[model samples]
Target: MRQLSELDASFLYLESANAPMHIGSIYLFDASERETPLAFSTFVSYLRSRLHVVPVFRQRLKEIPLRMGHPYWIDDPDFSIERHLAYVSLGENSREASLMTLASKILEEPLKRDRPLWHITFVDGFQLGGDKEGNPGFALIVKLHHAAIDAFSGAEIMGKLLEYTPKPQPISAPRPWQPRPKPSEERVMLQAGANILRTPWRVTSIAAGAVEATARGLIQKQLRRIPLSFPLFTAPHSPFNRQITANRQIVSAKLDLSRLKAIKATLGDVTLNDVVLGLCAETLRRYLGDQNASNDESLVAMTPLSVRSSTLNRTTGNQMSAMLLDLATNEQNPAKRIRRIHWNAVASEPYREAIAADRLTELLPSAMLALSARLYSELQIAQRYQPVFNLPITNIPGPQVPLYLQGARLVQQYNAAPLFDSMGLVIVAVSYQGSLTLNFTMCPDVVAKGNSLRNHAYASLDAIEQAASMLDPEDMHTPLEETRSQSMADSAMNLLEGSLKKLTSRLRR
Candidate 1:
């Protein structure tokens, strides 16, 4: 059995009642042709067949005999698809409110580890008002432990589960279940003996690595320590950042990627990610300004960076480091902020040294590695010594083409990420098809009027779009047709006032 990766273990350990530490997606599907009884059985049978091939699908933790091993399907296990999937009907309410309520329910408690590593809730019977052309749709919420898959691999797994064609022939035959023999007491003792044999060399290597890390930390103390002193604009202590209850609120916005792409084209090679961050920064700025709690200090965001190689794409667990970015909200111009963000991201360096140190520790004996990890986590050297960012931003890329689930055409998608105690706000962006849907999950107490954040986000995008359009020197002088008319009206009033003053002077003479 393969051991749990360090990234996966970290997620498992960091989980608490307030934060479940699971990544989930909400997919809206247009109504499709109904499946026959035989077809439905075929679908379930296909899933069962797939599960046999994928070891992770059926595996539950074997914590007692073995600490953690590759998941093996539980034989004759209790499997209830109905319990995992739920159907709800809202009474005379907006879809957004219904979705928010559903999100709150999902985050109410962490998943039980006695069963599978993941669960899905297929929500049908949604009654959203729309034009005749718009068809009725249902939502599928898929929640999986972070240890089970990274964002990229998760998308791949989703692709595998869906079909490209409208209707396909069903596969025949379920594989016979054959449980592998559990390791005996003697085998366990033999494993322990092997670990003991390697302990000395492992200790020596770890000690040397620690020395090197210490030296590097000393040399780069200034850069590493800056995050600590960086003042947070919304540093107002709120219940959100304090100990949290087992409740969560999720809000999402479907943004047009084509608009973002248009802006990027005008701005010259700026990434869609930069545009997203810029919008978030502007939104925060406006929200704080509205509350009269605006600060001149730059807002910082913690962006997770994936460290996995192409070869490790299917590997589960978190292989992530963070980069603290200055949102530059103090700047009034949106274009300047976008440019600054792009440059800052480009200039930032990856934590290669720290990753190397982590890799070195992995080479040590299991016991020693576990001990070192525990010490590091308990100390929280990264959080304490490093500057505390205001929020966490995650970007998960999804399938470019339309995806279908159970014959329904998948439309919109939203991602829900965890919010740490210190970082009250977590912004997640998932690109599905041609749209970049942004989801914000935050502490309600800290961010009062969370819905307003969506409005500000739209305004920020508008500002950026306007700025990008003004890239042409001629366009800049013309003041844009939308603004030009307003400016002319104001100028005309000023000219009339000057003429009136002269006429009054002549009359007085």
Candidate 2:
């Protein structure tokens, strides 16, 4: 049996009814490409044939006696592909909004612990609504527990499951399945006891490493004379950091990837990620402005970073870190916000705290890690702290080439990441083919205005696109566009300043 790493196991302990720890993606397939319409049975057969490609699909978690340790993955003797796959019909309504709502409903509950932590729901009879009305297409809703894979690993697994060619290639014959016998409770208990004994030295090593890294970070910060970004708990309380509930609402919008690339090209020194964050900043700015909330303070976003090496690309489990960066939502200029975000991301990489946290996870025993997480959850420590970050912004790079399931051509793909304690919003951006899809998962209890946020996301994209179009390569504005663009910027800044002044006055009183 292979034991779960602390980072993987923490997802288990962090899970509660109010916060389900799983992330998933939705894949839309255009069935018109196929000579015959793609059926659910055909998709199931495809998944079954490729089941051996990813071992995690057949493995189930086994707990130690008395919960003394983290769970282990063992091949399930009774594993059935049918158990993990199901079919859902959209019925009368097959609009994109309806599909998102159905997807949210499907993911409302936590995955069953008794089975493999991944489930697939094949949605049939969805209308793409092209030149032909009721042109039947289909969608595949894939949900995988966080313990099984991070976004990077999950993307790799997706590539493994799909094909580069529409013509189905014959899969290799599977080797005979030999199930390993389950370990006895006494053996597991004894093993847990031994692991507990070694915890101190392991923890000591981790602490030393963290201290060294932190010291290096501090020295780097001092030499650069750049103040560290806003610390956790410093983020002003917003609707995003309230008590969360299980009820969730999900929505998505797509941005032209070429336009994003053009923005990066036009803004010479900016990266695609910088452009993405700039859009998110504007989205939050508009969203907060609508709520009559203050945008004077910058909001912090916990951005996930991939730690996987090229050699370990095929390996599963979590090998990720996170960085906290100020979103600069208060900045009214789109161009300036993008540049600042780029610089902040570059400066903050050297001081990433998530690496130290990951190191601690690597050294600490599972039981100890789980215990600490349990305490943090049960005691509601998040409420006491201001908030480590306002929300999580994750960007997963997907295949630029088209992926196919049997003969159906994959069209649009969107993804949603699970929300953690007090984190009401998680923005997952995934680029497929030439489109970047922004999927938002919000806890209804905290972010009651989910639909509004979704609309603002699209609006922000439009604003950024407009801003990028107006700027010349030299950052000089043509006489014709300069006046109009400047007017727009000035108008926004005036309103923002007025709002900030009022907020300051209210706080002073």
Candidate 3:
């Protein structure tokens, strides 16, 4: 059995009746072109064939005695794919709204811990009501515990489950499975004690590294003349920052990635991510404006920055750092707002969080860590403090080419990130094939304007594209950090020349 990382275990602690800490995606597939359409049984068979590819599906969590520490993942001897897979059939006239309602209901119930912390609900009888009048399709609502996979690994798992061609791929032979005996209570206690013994030194070293990284970051920021935005808890009080119920509202929209790229090119050096932040800013700006609320407060976003690389071990756990980006919602001009966001993105580095996450399992005692997290949620400490950030925005890049599941082409995909107690709303952006999909998950009571908000989000993207087109190419300036780097290079060259001349004079004398 392998121990769960602190980052992964925290999800378990943070979960509550009101807040379910699982991240999921809604996958839409068009099956009209297939000679024989797929059914629930077919989907289950395909998934079962691919189970060997992803071992996490067959693993279950085993908590230590008396909650001494984090949980461990062990192979379940009684693992059954049927237990994790369910089927849901909608009416022929079901629309997007109907599907969303079903999704919300499914998400309200937490995943059972006795089994693997994942489930997939296959939805059939969905018909695209637009120009393609009667073309039928299917939707797959995939629910996986955050402990199992983050955004990067989630996409990787999707690739493993899907294929580029309709032809069935030969399934590899499954290894004969054997379950190991559960660890004794004494063994668990001994391991927890060992971890306790090592934590102090580990934490001390990590603290020192974090301090050094922070100091270096501050110096670098000063050298570059970069102005940092407001600190955490600086976000103004808003309705979205209050406690929320368990009921969730889901909304989604698709935008053209080509258009986003064209807009990015027109906007000079700003990235596609900056454009996404700008779109969120405009969406909130308009949302507040419509409510007659104050829109002068600058909003901050808590974006997850993945730290995993090819060199790291491919484990089933969270490998990410935290980035707090300034959305600059107070800025009226979309161009300037995006520029500020770009500058912040350039100046910010995921130094401390990355270091902490790398050593989290070693530094923190799991029992105390879990206890603190549980207390934080149970007591609603999040509501007491000013919000650290206004909301979370995670944008994950997806495959550029279409993916197929048993010959059914995947048309669009939307992903939803978990929300905490106080933070009522979170935005997850994912790009698939040629389209970028925005998925918004929030407390329905807090954000009752779901439909209108989605429309505003769409319009905001258009506005950003328009603003990009109107930008004067010559007027755009490079970021201050880049300019400072160039200046420092020129100064170094001059200093080198002066030193060379001095040396030559000394030699001649």
Candidate 4:
């Protein structure tokens, strides 16, 4: 049986009813045809075929005795799609708040471990009657354990399940499902013996790498001592930096990536990631400003970096390390904040080194990794360091073209990820079909204006887009000049007033 990685097992052990240890996506589909083109059963059949090659999709946990090894994937004999899928239609009086309430109820309960450790619910016959043209649509909510796949790999797997164009017919039926036969005791013993023999060399190599990494970290720290003096590098103390609740909140917004790309091109040398972080930083600035909250301190965000190589694309589990980014929201100008974020991104070398060390730790024996993980958990339980960051922010790239699921046209996609013990907010950005959708999931108590924060995120993008258009030589700064127009000023004032109202309502509530 293949064992769980230290990162993977930690997610399993830390799960609770309030905080389900799973990440999920919600897809809203709009179909042109009047008739229901894809029956729910047909979609299930397609999913079953996809699961044959992607075994993790169909298997559940097979926990082994002792933390000596990782959990095994056993074929779920009692698997039922009905238990996992749900069908729902919003009534005339339903509000977004009600939808959020329902979502919270769904998220509060942890996934059953005895089953395939994953589930997908199809919510059909949804009609928002807004800018969506009153089309009847459905929502697909998929939940998979953090142990199963990290964000990047998860996106890749999702792309595989979808098709750019509709297939004339569904693929042929999959072969009968089968469990992996258990190995003989003799073979198990021989493998254990071999592992024991190779343990010393692996252990030695790990030690050597740790020493080298430590030396490098020290040298880099010394070289960058001056710029690191800011609170940007130091950990902050807040209520969020404590043992976490087993609960989550997920909300999403979609923005045009091409517009963002235009901004980046005009900015020169700034990356797409920099623009994303900049937007978040600006949003936080406006959010706190509207709430009359303190703005002296910078916000720390834990940004996950994928260390996976091309060859390891299909591999599952976490191969990620995080860099604590100081969202220098104290800076008033958006462009300047963008530049500062870019520099801070460059200076976050030590965290990358720490992540590299983590990669080495994973190559050791399962027992060793488990012991180390337990010790790490104990340290967290004790609350050793001041919490290093405020929230976790991740960006996962998705397909550039529209994708279809069982013939329903996917309009928007959003992701919800876990918040660690010390973090209360997670902002995950998924780029699909030329738009960058930002999903903001946070503790309701911590984020007083959650919906406003979502709006501010989009507003920040609008501000950047305007600035970039102004800087463009060909565009003649027409859009930027228009910002000063009576109509534009009035619109901006209205938005600011609306946001203030929302913030006040949230705080009072």
Candidate 5:
């Protein structure tokens, strides 16, 4: 039995009825070239053949006796592919909007723990979106628990499941498979006992390492004077920073990846990620301005960074860290906004080592970590503290080459990350086959105007594109004030004041 790590197990403990911890992707495939339609039986057969590739599919969580240790992943003797697969018919209304709505509804519920922490829904009646109306296509919605894999790991698994070439040879049926016998209870106790005994020394060692790394990081920061914004002290509370509900709405817009790359090239020192941030910043600026809730301080985004080493062969669980990034929404000039984002990201690279997820997860026991998270939600702690880096902004890199499953060419792919208390919005942008699709995953309870965000993304991209086209690289950083206290204090005092005012208004009511 393969036991879950402390980090992976926390995802299980942290899960609530409303706040489900799962990540999902929608893969729309174009099978118009096929002589015959892809049959459900054929697809299921193909999936069954590939089950051995991702071993987690045949395993389910086996809890320790009386929660003495993290859950163990054991082969489910009765595991059936049918339990994890479903087919949904979209009927005549196969527009992109309808697909997104259906996805939102499906994602609103948590996955059953009795089975493997993943589900694949086959969606029929999908029209080829964007002017190609009558051309029929099908889609697959895959949901995997965050405990099973993070975004990077998910991408790796996706690559393994699909084919690289369009004309690959067909996969033949395999011989009957056998699962390893369930481990004896005595062995389970022994494994858990080993982990328990190691926890004290391991935790001490982890603490010492964290302190040393933090000291080194602070010294580097002081010597260079990188005015980078840290978490609690700087992030401002936005409208979306309140508690969220299970009611979710997702919106997506596809963009030409080449245009973003060209912008990155034109901007010289800027990266494609910087360009993406600029577009998101402008999107928020427009949405907030329309709602008459614009902030003088720029919003901060907690950006997740994958920390996987090339030598490591495993592509599962959460091997990631995060940095709090300034979106620079307060900057009106599109060129200046992007450049600031680039500079800030470049400046903050050194600090990544201090806050790596591996180090942070070791600071607390798995059970304690889970309990703390639950208390933070139940006690409404977010309302009292400065919002911890507004919301999550994750960028998942995808294969530039085309991918195929069962001879159907994958066209557009969109993804959504799970939401939690005080984090209503999660911006998940993924790229596939020369196109980048930006998806907004929002809880309608906290962000009432969630739909408006995507519509504004187009305008946001246009504005940034125009600015990059017209301006020279040297002219991008024409800032009124040169320095930012990591760009937080220059105008961020306004946010602290704004948060106070909001709090006061709430008290009055």
Candidate 6:
């Protein structure tokens, strides 16, 4: 049995009934090429045979008596894979929209603490992808608690579960699992006491390191003259920045990856991520404008950045940090926002070393941190003050090549991440094959019309693309004019110019 790191246990403590701390994905796969249809029984047997590869699949969390220390991952004595699997047939209602709606509800429910913190559901009857209507496909929805695995590690587990080749590999013989006896209450208490004794030394070292890190970060920021957004400091409250309800709504939008890359190619000194952030900024600006909400101030986003490569000897748990970003949502021309975003990311990159997750986890006492998180949620402090960051945006990079599950080639992949109080919305982007899918998860009460927002994203990206095409390849770094005409007629003419250019290019092609 292994004790959960401070970073991992923090997720457990921070979770509330309204905010279930789990992350998951919806995958659409084509199984028509298989000799026989992929049956629920066959899939269950297939998953059961691979349990040895991921030991955490069968283990459940066991807390210490009176929560004296972090929880332990103990093998569930009564473990049964049957209890963790389910099958559903959508039949005629198996459209992608129906599937996403169902996924939202499943993702909101909390996982049972009595069992392993993961579950899977096999969905049949999804419509065929691309041409060939008769080509059969199915959807798979899987959820795992954030405490067990973050997005990066989840991808590692997926690499273990899926295959790189179309040819199915032979399943190995079942290896029996042995369950160790649960630790006695006395032993658990003693372990907690030992951990408590060691905290003083850890705190001392962590405190010293934190001060040094802060000073170093300040020096770098001043030397570079870069503006960075910090939690509760620069973020201004917005219409959606409030405590969220239990209910949630979800929507998925797909776009061509090549087009985003083309924008990056046309624009020098800007990363592809800058283009994605620009899309989000413009999309949200239009969304709020459509609702008649004020867009006077640019919205901020809390983007999660993985630090796995920088971290040393990190076998498991979360290895990430977040930085606040000014999305420049108020920019009149959505196409012009990428340059500002590029600058924002560049300025924020230097500050990452100061707030790395690994260092913070070492400094903070787990028990104290857990209590503080629980108290913060219960007291509703998030409602009283400015939010830490508006919402989380996770950009997950996926394999460009096709990945197969039991010989079924994956055609589409959508991601879903957890939400918390005062943070109603979260965006997850996954690029696979040649497409990038953006999944919007939000509380319906806080952010209405999730689909409407998604539709706006399409229009926003189109505007950006048209404007990008008009940019000159040489001297691409020329500043896009920041000032926009306030008159409606001038705005209309500007849009018309881009639209006509897009039409001409289409005709030329």
Q: Give all candidates' CA lDDT scores.
A: 0.59, 0.74, 0.73, 0.64, 0.76, 0.73
- Listed per model in order, the count of residue pairs whose N, CA or C atoms clash below 3 Å is 4, 1, 0, 5, 2, 0
Q: lDDT for model 6, on a 0 to 1 scale? A: 0.73
Query: What TM-score would every model get versus the actual structure?
Result: 0.73, 0.83, 0.84, 0.76, 0.85, 0.83
Residue by residue across 114-182, what tens digits does model 3's lDDT show? 999999999998785465476788899988999888877888888888999866565545556666676
* Candidate 4, 239-278: lDDT as tens digits: 4455556556676777889877877787776788988889
Off by more than 4 A, model 1: 32-46, 52-54, 64-96, 128-134, 168-177, 184-193, 196-242, 312-315, 351-387, 471-509
Model 3 CA deviation exceeding 4 Å by range: 129-132, 170-175, 200-232, 313-315, 349-363, 473-475, 478-509
Which digits, one per residue and each the tens of the lDDT, describe model 6 over residues 247-339? 878787889999889888776778888888887888888888887888886677777778777554433578787555767777676555787
Cα-based lDDT at residue 5, candidate 6? 78
Error of 5 at 160 (Å): 1.4
Regions more than 4 Å wrong, model 6: 129-134, 200-233, 310-315, 349-354, 358-364, 471-509
Pairs clashing in candidate 4?
3-70, 4-70, 18-246, 18-247, 19-246
lDDT of 1 by residue, 391-460 (tens): 7787877778877655666777777776554555788888878988789887675567888888888887
lDDT-best of 1 and 2: 2
Per-residue lDDT for 148-199 in model 5, tens only? 8998899899889888776644877854779888888889878867876764
The segments of candidate 2 whose C-alpha lies over 4 angstroms from its true place after superposition are 130-132, 169-175, 200-232, 349-357, 360-368, 466-509
What is the model-wide C-alpha lDDT for candidate 1?
Answer: 0.59
On the 0 to 100 scale, the lDDT of residue 140 in model 1 is 63
Question: Best TM-score goes to which candidate?
Answer: 5
Measured with C-alpha atoms, the lDDT of residue 508 in candidate 4 is 36
lDDT agreement of model 5 with the native? 0.76
Where does candidate 4 stray beyond 4 Å?
74-84, 89-101, 128-133, 183-233, 238-243, 313-315, 347-354, 357-385, 466-509
Candidate 5 regions with alpha-carbon error over 4 angstroms: 130-133, 200-233, 349-354, 470-473, 476-509
TM-score for candidate 6, please give it. Answer: 0.83
